[model samples]
Target: MDVPLPLVPAKILTAPTTITQFPDYPKTLILEQCKTIKDLNQIHAHLIKTRLIHNPRVAENLLESAAILIPNLPMDYPISIFEKLEEPNSACYNLMIRAFTLKQSPNEAILLFNEMCGRSVRPDEFTFPCILKACSRLHALMEGEQIHALIMKYGLGSKGFGSNGFVLNALIGMYASCGEVEVARHLFDGMSERSVGTWNSIFSGYIRSGCWEEVVGFFREMLEMEVGFDEVTLVCVLTACGRLNEIELGEWIHEYVVAKGLKGNPTLVTSLVGMYAKCGRVDTARRLFDEMPRRDVVAWTTMISGYSQANRHREALELFHEMQKTNIVPNEVTMVSILSSCAVLGALETGKWVHSYVMKKRMKLTVTLGTSLMDLYLKCGSVGNAIEVFRKMPSKNVFSWTVLIQGLANNGQGKRAIQFFNSMVEKKITPNNVTFTGVLCACSHAGLVDEGRGFFVSMTREFGIEPEIEQYGCMVDILGRAGLIEEAYQFINNMPIQPNAVIWRTLLASCRVHKKVEIAEESLKNVVKLEPMHSGDYILLSDIYASVGRLEDALRLRNQMKERVIKETPGCSVIEMNGIIHEFFSEDNIHPDLVEVYNATENMMEKIKLAGYVPNTTGARLDAEEDDKESSMSHHSEKLAIAFGLIRTSPGTTIRITKNLRVCMDCHNATKIISNVFNREIVVRDRNRFHHFKDGSCSCNDYW
Candidate 1:
């Protein structure tokens, strides 16, 4: 076949001496200059015509460059050339083995290695590393052990045959990558002289297996022995530090990197950012990220994720917008972080836009991304959207199922959540502690006291899952919400673990609801000792005292709160419209449309009052007059948000609101009336659970 030659300089093609006149190794120098497969084909044909294809250096170089070094070439080209050789040498075998490994064909590499062994070709030091790397990729521990035996049989171990550390380094790496970290450690300790690569292999092993402590200890030993380290070493240690939250050691490493003048390296700098970010020093992480000369997707994603982890969700969303301005495309990880931020802020429109973007970009609905989207919808009071995402997911893991179950529980679909949990169990998915928390929460919100007790016992007896404090809290909530105040208090006292402030607060809140002032006082005593300055605890107790006609006690408690400088957490609510989040604070006048919103709120109060809505002012100040208390109840954050929603959205549109605190009974009752009077569905996600109000009813049925 006539091979078409590529466009090349005439002077080079017609040089005074053709490549044939050069020595075999020099001929390879010419082969290295071939830019494309066509260029290589022209030279390859010329070499075959000139009877120079037999030269090992020329053949191996052509195969290595074309098959491995060159970009975008197919594997068949080199494999065909390799087969045409009359007697392929070990060098050609090594080239193909490496090509297979690097090109994501580790299986082929292993098969070729076995063929080489079957052909009785002697493996060299270079050959072992290539094959060992292939073994590492495949996690072929059995094959790797066979290779190790070959190493010993051929006297290629560190103790025998002209020992170089390359073979042993590869061996250690293979063992580590196969999850035999201890064996890797054993090999590492037996080394008479260790290279930087040797240390890195063991560190990688420890990291891959999540043995973070071993990494830290080995790094300490490396420092003590005065072993010189490089960027690889620092990156490894920094990763371990990030996972372990070793901020002090991570800081020292940062200083060392600065002293070594390695601060210019982007990877090392990104590692520093991750280390600081994981340790809750997001500000420092941002500073370093800002100073980076170049920020890739990974660096940007790390910083955004750091913000989400620290609960600085708004900043994460802001940073994501900034990232979009640049050329770097936000990947799935970036989307997950941004969605998490949107979930916390209740930015439903923004979350929907992100979901649309994912669809437009044709990104796969991976479990992580899908779960995040479901969470965003669930938190934003979009239960239908969340359920849709959950159903469309191609695969479901324990976490994905748990997120769905928890989201359903939060959305007041507790019965459905429990059904989903049963389905998950029938499918043989083991539930973790978080799953049970969601399950118990479903029972608690649905007022399934009997079912809650059954599962709480079944968690340990059937699944061997220990009941964490969260599950215990759910039980208390379950009993308390059902008006079993005595049983709830007994359950708290008989708990295996010591009760925390949250437990006492749960009981206290229940007491206020059930009008048990005596138990409320006792619960307050325990809560005060555990969390003295907690505003909610004090507020709950005060409300209970006022409900039982102890106005003096309520007034005295309010005075104590003021004297102690403890203020109630102001209620905040968020609603999304036109892709932007609008926040309403109690009695807030800072919004751009404050006058309009307040007018709408007053109008809403009038309409609901005509529908027989009355403000329940049990928690109001005992010193305030009835009119002042009623007026105060009218401006609650959620009520204002609902009024704003009624104004901004067209009639009949569902109004969704997320509140920072539990919705007060007055707002809840008024909202139910407002929903019926206005003929609209209002979904309010309080701090605890969802309340869907429509036609003079709530999803919780006034139980919560």
Candidate 2:
């Protein structure tokens, strides 16, 4: 039998005493009055001097206050106190463990628990909870499993050892934090009495792991069990809804929130905003945002990001400006959304302002912010600035490399883009699917067919990246752009994955370039099957028919389009002049100086014809005389936009135009002649590719 220690005398416990010539004070009163480290130290000296240091009650009180309640006291002080004790009790160990857990030094708590175990001190229910909490905090799965075995060995998991809801809840949390959600769920399912905290733990785990469907399923079960949820539970469910885009369920949850009068909760309201925004209801999200009594940085960021994702870039920028007017500061996320909007709008001036703001604020150049800057500069036609940003970035991820390469390819520097890809490889950075897409695109645009084929083979064989549909589409584009129409068709037929409409459309576009009527019809057949309502495919097929002198077939197709009410998307071109985008459609007369633009276009046509330009009337579909065809081609939207750009912009300043449709052959020929006659460089970005016309020659070399 273990020997029991003698109890301390009543005089030692209750009498007034002094240590080291200090004033006499009762030890209990001193311990109770101890609030700061100074008082604890004075009481500690008194205990040591009075020979009451071994008193269990006195030791417990000192350890509890110093380890937990006393602020600004070093943890080492309480740890030293515990270490000096001859035989510390479970309560003493529990106090220190809980202290370390709260202090975020969970490994220390584990060490203390290990020391407690080594000393053969049996842990009670409270001891297990604190140590298990430490395990959860550290995500120490193996140590937690060992502690779990100990709990079972001691019967502390059952009522025999007084293990209650707190212990079980900690157990669930520990497993969940270790990423063992299934095991946590097993424990949860076996529990006869589950607390709200238990459900929250499991739900949060599923959310953290991105098991969105399971989150919904468990939430449903939680409701069936009638477990009352708090703000945390609803927030998690709403997040899941946003991830899955379950708009209806999100609305129902909103109704529930309203029914429970929880609409006033800012956190839940933020979740609702994010959910509605992600589910394609920005108006609803904005309504909730307006209703909120207070808005924080996160709420503003959410709304801004939602608008950016919805392509409402103007609104996103407006909200960002509004956020700056308030006391709330813009974070990196806010800046990123702003830059994305600028990229989409090709707003170089606005993007430059944002970049200056970032420098003035001395914000850290993180990868995400740096990538956004690169994209903004690239889309705004400033390749030099984009390259400078890429080089200055302290870190570059795969996405950074991919963006630089794609930007180069898109700007018609395909050969330089391939060189960059080689540089990326020499740096030992692994290329992902997007990186390969950029590489293949570079090869395709530069007419490096053999090199493109080699990379496509190496992607799957060497890099172990299974070719996605995007890769297959790139290959088709490669073959099609190279005039290997038969090979492109063969590749599409042999594809393991089903070809999407984009792939068929790529083949169809190439068919039009080569005037391969049979292949164009076959590609159109597949495209129409996949996307029946797509007007572009139908228009392309009709164009192909009209090009081959089959007027009846072309007219039939056009009539069918009219009967189905499939309106062709009218061709429009946008030209940015003085930071304002000017949009023009075919035969558009909307500009204030429309008459001036038309006169300039007529004069340019005359000048180009003097340079031996002849209109390619085959590009026109009207069954009329050559004069009518030539007249129809003259008023094309891109030509009108070019004329407007030439008139508005200064002489010799490169005019840039963006078109919704591919540039027709007549427009292409006329643009080359105009570039030579006017001594100006004209850059046109069509839906297909860029056409850089200078001195009677085009960058695409008549291939496009």
| CA lDDT scores, all candidates in order | 0.89, 0.85
Model 1 weakest lDDT span, ten residues long: 13-22
lDDT of 1 by residue, 44-110 (tens): 7777887777787778777887788778898999998899887778989999999999999999999
Off by over 4 Å in 1: 1-67, 70-164, 170-180
For candidate 2, the TM-score is: 0.75
Q: Which ranges of candidate 2 are over 4 A from the true structure?
A: 1-180, 190-193, 575-582, 589-617, 621-657, 666-685, 688-704
